[model samples]
Target chain A: MAQNQSAPDATRRSERSRRAIYDAALALVAEVGYPKTTIEGIASRAGVGKQTIYRWWSSKADVLLEAFLDLSGQAAEAAAQDRPSADASPYGIPDTGDLAADLKHVLRATVDELRDPAFEAPSRALAAEGVVNEELGRRFVATLLEPQLQLYVDRLRSAQEAGDVRPDLDPRIALELFVSPLAQRWLQYTGPITYEYTDTLVDYALNGLAPR
Target chain B: MAQNQSAPDATRRSERSRRAIYDAALALVAEVGYPKTTIEGIASRAGVGKQTIYRWWSSKADVLLEAFLDLSGQAAEAAAQDRPSADASPYGIPDTGDLAADLKHVLRATVDELRDPAFEAPSRALAAEGVVNEELGRRFVATLLEPQLQLYVDRLRSAQEAGDVRPDLDPRIALELFVSPLAQRWLQYTGPITYEYTDTLVDYALNGLAPR
Candidate 1:
């Protein structure tokens, strides 16, 4: 009975330490950027030993990737909770039989998230590093970004089956029409991101910029 | 005779120093990135006095911006010389009556420019800095990027006037359908950039993704 009680207490302690490490990693990355962000700094900030960080994650990159993944998962969950549907998957786009509406809805949520202070600073720092560091960029894309992009691919494939999108359209490339515009605006400050802007992107992408 | 002889020599020396400075600035930015690149470094690398750089350009940002502008101008001039027309503006897109063909041709050339090692490294460094620094990003966009995007707006406007594009579409936003995809791929390594990829983007952007 004492061993069982000790197991639960130890599990709770580990979970608390994990959360603290994630917070520290994110804060350090945001403050100092990717290059200056170190495993030692994260450990010091989290009030844990350097060995504690190594025990859980091998590198600063690994710590950051997991922290970001956790943060994004929480954001998706929060967004899901805000919706009317009880069955919405946190990472999935709504397939409400209207491809344009669904895309616009998800994109609008993205606009809000991009503006959020919690998400913006660290994401910009990591993304800025990725632009110059090809190895890290590929890893970030493969692990974090690609999974999110695949969600759109899945949605587009379903749209193809439902006759909402062109059957011959490569879902991967087709999704870039609306998605890439918003990304460029956020990443490059090329333009403002608003619901109206995203809505226009959907309309132009679906109807074509050329006369239909 | 003495003054006339020295005038041409002085002009030639000034021109050589300017080119050397530009080359040095670009190389330093490419090697060490923006934040670490300094006037002293550029001066030392160019074999010129710090005062010489200050005599012409106000800051390192100014020096780098002008260097990039000069490099881009030379590249644009080379591209213009390759074209069939003697009248093509280096900064302007070709306005063949067939809009799709013209846009594809230019984007293909852009793909070539993007792959150039001399262009890629310095551009990536500057762009990465711009991602994190909004002030510099805005200035970079205004000076270097927006002017290029304006060329697209001009072409699209012409397409609209000729009844090739929808009369109601905003040209600025409309151009992003194709342009932003290429930008995102190049900036993020999200996908492979090829003539085929850019060509397909043009087709999808011009034609609706929905079944006609």
Candidate 2:
């Protein structure tokens, strides 16, 4: 019984330390951005030794990636709470069988996430770093961005099966019609993102801009 | 006659200095990126005084913007040489009455531009700055990006009048389907770009991503 209790306590302690580390890493990255954020800074701010961070993660990039992943999970949980189904994750695009509606829903949620202060600062920092660092840019795209984009691919594939999307269309490129526009607007500050704007993108994408 | 010849000589010298300044600004931005690129640095590298840059432009961003504008004009002129029609701009999207083909052609040119080593470095530098800095970001979008995007808007508007595009579709948002995807991929390293990829994007945008 004592061993079992000690195991749980240890797990709880580990969880606490992990959360603290994540918080520190996110805060430091937001404040100073990726170029200046260091392992030592995160460890110091988290009240953990730098060795402790090294024991768990190889680099600041690793720590930040994990932190961002955790943040995404948390955002999903927050998003899930609003939906009727308890089992659904808010992390992926909704497949409510209406492709346009589902896409619009996901894109709007993305807009909200982009606007959220909790998500914005660290995201901006990582994004700014990605702009200058090719290796990190590719790695982040592969790990974070590609997976999220794959959700769209999956949705588009489902649409293809249902005969909702063109059979000849590449799901990857097709998804970008509605998706990348929002991303470019957000990432590049090219335009305002209203629910109206995203909704309009869905409509324009679904009907050829040419007379259908 | 001698005075007229001397005036032409002065003009040529000034033009040479201006070109040198533009080259230096582009090189500095590529080397150090936007935030670190300084007017003094551009001046030293151009072999011109800081006052010379100040006389022409108020800030490094101004100088860089003009440099990009000049570069874009040069690229357009180079592209123009390959065109069959004497009347058509090599820089302008061909209005061949087939909206899809015209869009694909222009996007393919953009794919080449995005991939070009000469264009990539400084373009990336300005784009990276646009991601984090709102003032410069907005200005770059307005001055440089919006103008290029507007050209697409113009072409789309023409397509609309020709009954090629839906009368109801907003050309501005409609253009985003093909345009923003390429922009996002280039800015974020989201994916590899190719003529095939751009062709696919044009096809997807021209037809509803949904089954026609």
Candidate 3:
């Protein structure tokens, strides 16, 4: 009976240690960026042995990726909880019959996510590295960016089936009309991103650039 | 009369030195990246003293910026010559009265420019630095990116007057739907760029995402 009780305590302790490691990894990456982040640095900051980090993840990139994934999931969950009406899908965008409204809703949430302090620094570090590092750039986009973009593709497909979007339009390219503008504004500091900017993008994209 | 001939020779030598400095600055940035590039290194590569660089430009940033502008001007001139048509304007996009075709033509040129090996490496170095360096990023966007983007804005304004685009749309933001998509694809390695891809972006931006 005592061993059984001790097992649960040990599990709790392990979980706590894992969280601390993730937090350290994220903070280190943000503070010093990707190239400077090391396993020893994360281990020291987390107050765990270097062996402890290695036991869980193979490399600094792995730790950082998982930490970011966790951070994004938490932010999404928090946003979803704050607004009960929000379409909270872990795997995809909400398929509300109104495609424009659904897209705008998701993009607005994305604005919040971009503004979130927890997500900003680490993401910027990764993004900056990806700018010059071709291998990392491809992997990061494949694993992180493409998945999110695919959600838009799926949503557009649904829009096509519903007759809201033109069947002839390639959803991949069509999604960029609304998506890439906000992304460029955020990445390049080209302009301010607000609900107003995103909303305008939707309207312009839905209606067309030319006179209707 | 001898002194007058010497004056012409001196002017030609100065022009050669200036071109050599610009070439060195771009080549160093591409080789070592932005952070590692220094005025001293540029000077050494140019076969001039560091003081010579300081005499002409205040900082490495200034040198790199001017170098890039000169490079882009050469590329544009080359592209213009390659075309069988009349002279292309240095200041604005072609406004051939056919808005879609003109936009597609310009964007295709941009696709070629981005893909050019001579432009790619140095550009990536500066762009990577821009991701983390806000002041430099803003400066680059203002001087280099914004000015080029404005040419599109001018073209779109003309389109609006011609009833090709809706007057209600913000051309600045409307332009991004097509422009930013290409930029993002190049900067992030998110997708492949081709004449076909840019052509599709033009169509989507000109038309609505919804059924016409």
lDDT of 3 by residue, B1-212 (tens): 99999999988987888899999999999998888899989999999888878888999999999999999889878877766565348545777788888899889999999999999999988987887788998888987899889888889998999999999888999999899999999989988999999999999889888998
Ranking by DockQ: 1, 3, 2
Considering the two chains of model 3, state its CAPRI-style docking category. Answer: high
The TM-score values for the models, in the order shown, are: 0.98, 0.94, 0.95
- List fnat, each candidate: 0.78, 0.81, 0.86
List model 3 lDDT by residue over A1-212, tens digit each. 99989999999999999899989998998898788899999999999999988888999888877887788778767866766465547546788698888889889988988888888888888888888888888877887788889889999998999999999999988999988998888788999989989999999999999987
Candidate 3 colliding pairs: A208-B207
Best by lDDT: 1
- Stronger candidate by lDDT (1 vs 2): 1
Choose 2 or 3, whichever is better by TM-score: 3
TM-score of chain A of each: 0.97, 0.95, 0.93
lDDT, candidate 1, equals 0.92
Q: Which CAPRI category fits model 2?
A: medium
Please provide, for model 1 over B133-171, each residue's C-alpha lDDT reduced to its tens digit, 9 standing for 90 to 100: 999888888888999999999999999999999999999
Per-residue lDDT of model 2, residues B172-208, tens digit only: 8888899999888887788888898888888778877
> Quick one: RMSD of model 3?
1.8
A1-212 per-residue lDDT for model 1 (tens digits): 99999999999999999999999999999998899999999999999999999998999999999999999989998999888684347679888888898899999999999999999999999999999999888888888888888999999899899998999999999999999999999888999999999999999999898786
Best by TM-score: 1
Please tell me what DockQ candidate 2 reaches.
0.76
The lDDT, on a scale of 0 to 1, for candidate 3 is 0.87
Give the lDDT of residue A50 in candidate 2: 94
